[model samples]
Target: MEHIVNMKSLTTEEMMKIIELAREMKADGIRKLDRTYYVSNLFFEPSTRTKSSFEMAERRLGMEVIPFAPESSSTLKGESLYDTVKTFEAIGLDLVVIRHPRDKYYEQLVDHMDIPLINGGDGSGQHPTQSLLDIFTIYEHFGQFEGLNVTIAGDISHSRVAKSNAESLKRLGANVTFVCPEEWAGEFDYTTDLDAQIENCDVLMLLRVQHERHDGEGLAFSKWEYHRQFGLTLERAERLQKHAIIMHPAPVNRGVEIADELIESPQSKILTQVENGVYVRAAIIKLLLKGRNE
Candidate 1:
């Protein structure tokens, strides 16, 4: 509870507590803290949803968000991540949220820092907040996780979302399946057939291909081919059960990861996931700060 670093480190009870708090906050609406807290975000990687969602969460909680640009920071002078974090600690900030490209980047800062650190993301390591929001969305729809069939498809090797969600969902008593091409499977056992799992799964979670992480190598098939085979084409989406939901942690590739029309379809919870992110993150910050004070 000290730092929201990895989903694997959280107990089932702890995870549920965050989800419950988020749900309550969503129902009750924003309630600013009696005292103001100052926070800063250090994202070394490119983002849209995660970064903005955290800022929204911080603002809603009445925390003063200190904006940061990695390009203009001391990092440009070769200052280390540890030094930069230490600098923030010295600046009297209450907490810091960081998203760095190095996997497990917070490992070096967590033990030494005085304030709590909420990991925005770290390489292909884990995205705990995103996982929480995704779980919240799922829980909101179904009211439970036990025995839910969750199939995650796409660039599993390079996705922090896939890694975080797979573990957390399985731990919460959901049956989790991974679908990806062999080259993108990474450490998990997976099948290349999205079609086979589509009808049976209660959740079809698509992922972006993450071309940036593929180094200089190109896919053997074109984007259209990938979409036809693995992506959620209109035909594939029709095969989903009525109760089934589609989700993507997006900056969506539109037609690349899913059919463009399906992004806002009735069964798609993609935007709801984004909306819930702010609440889930607010709950996390509240819990971490509450724990720190006690």
Candidate 2:
């Protein structure tokens, strides 16, 4: 029943070490073939990057990837999450990757099972894998997060991205700042009174407001004000540290969270983040499996 729940299992060094290994696995050139190892992804909600990356990770490592999309799974037919998990466990899956809208969903399941859990995300609580990929991308680009001023903007309250990013960045030596409308700012509920949380950082990490997740949460706001107050506009982008980089964990809310202009800027690393994500996930799977025997 052991598991990697949120960032608790990773210190800055261990996390970076995993990401670096993931990179090497991705670059191995020769694809190994092993159809015996089974990995299951049990995600209750929708995700493109996460599911795909996990799928690619297993495939690249020669493991069998169980069907990932929730819509295509038996859970859509009134099966409780626990029942679904048990079914997968019964089938002797080697690893489980889960994402659910409720925080602690996997931890509760882990309490009952013999399998290992890799939490894709649990509501707005945390997305550790994404955080690792983000740090890896930044480290690969700049070689360091320390002394860098990095800003995470948008839907801070309900964004696992912002929460994990802030913690992950700081743990890795970056000075982190968060920007969002007061309602959706970082989960911390307080900023240190710096302008745009942009005073002196090397990067700006923009987060997308989950429009669908906010529908009933009462955190939704008009698109105009959203972009006006927090987005990276032409003028706003001009104010960054001369060498600052722009980052976003994508499925970006283009016109709303970031102006159309900044997405294509020389500083933008949105696509790069996506690419590195697959590599990092592959690395994690390899690391976990390789070390399972020890």
Candidate 3:
């Protein structure tokens, strides 16, 4: 519980504790912390949801958020990640949340820092908080994870969401499946067909096709073709089970990962996932700060 770095390192009890706490906070509004603490967010990549969600979470807990922008900071002058973090620690900040483009970027900081570090994201590596919120959203709907069939579809090779959720969902006793183009499957076993998974899955979790990570390479298929083949078209949406839910770790390419019409569909939990992120993150901060005091 020292660093909220990755899902693989968390025990089932710890994950459940965070989820339950998030649910409680969602039911009863967040209560401010007894003492104000200071935090900073260091995002080296562009973000909307995670950055804003963490800010909302910190404010809800009555924590002071120190604003930081890398372009304006010492990083432009070649300050190392470790050096930057040390600077923040020297400033007496209580905690830090970081999202960097490099994978496992927190590794170097974790051993050297005294303050807790919450990873917002690392390059296609892990997004533990996003995974927790996603888990919280699913639990909110179904009341459990055991034996649930979760199908994760899209850019598996480049999605931190897919990686984090796949490991966590399996650990929590859910049967997990990956659907993606063969080249995008990465190290996981996967099926190319989304249709076959539609009827059985309790959660159809779609990931954005991370074109930014493709290193200037062009997609083999056009958007229409990708949508027809892999995206959740209205035709395919008809096949989902009665109790099944649709999800996306979005910044959704409306016609790419899923149809535009389904974004607000009755079965879609995309917006709920975003809303739950605030409470889930608040719970994480509360627990981590509480753990620090003890």
RMSD of 1: 0.6
The stretch of ten residues in a row with the least summed lDDT in candidate 1 is: 211-220
lDDT of 1 by residue, 1-294 (tens): 899999988999999999999999999997898699999999999999999999999999999999899989989999999999999999999999999989999899989999999999999999999999999999999999999999999999999999999889999999999999999999999999888999999999999998888898899899999999899999998899999999999989989999999999999999999999999999999999999898
Error of 1 at 164 (Å): 0.4
Which digits, one per residue and each the tens of the lDDT, describe model 3 over residues 1-294?
788999987999999999999989999999999999999999999999999999999999999999999989999998899999999999999999999999999888898988889999999999999999999999999999999999999999999999999889999999999999999999999999999999999999998989999999878999999999899999989999878999998899998889999999999999999999999999999999888889
Model 1 Cα displacement at 89 (Å)?
Answer: 0.5
Give the 10-residue window scoring lowest on summed lDDT in candidate 3: 106-115
Candidate 1: where are CA atoms >4 Å away? none
TM-score of 2: 0.89
Residues 1-294, model 2: lDDT tens digits: 146667766777778777777667556742553445889988787889988888887777788877756777777788888888888889888888888999878755877876677889999899988998888888887987778777777778888888787777877778776666666654475562335465465778878878667767654557876677777777777777767778888888888778898888888888888888888777776666655645
Better of 1 and 2 by lDDT: 1
The alpha-carbon deviation from the true structure for residue 119 of candidate 2, after best TM-score superposition, in angstroms, is 0.9
Model 2 poorest 10 in a row by lDDT: 186-195
- Every model's TM-score: 0.99, 0.89, 0.99
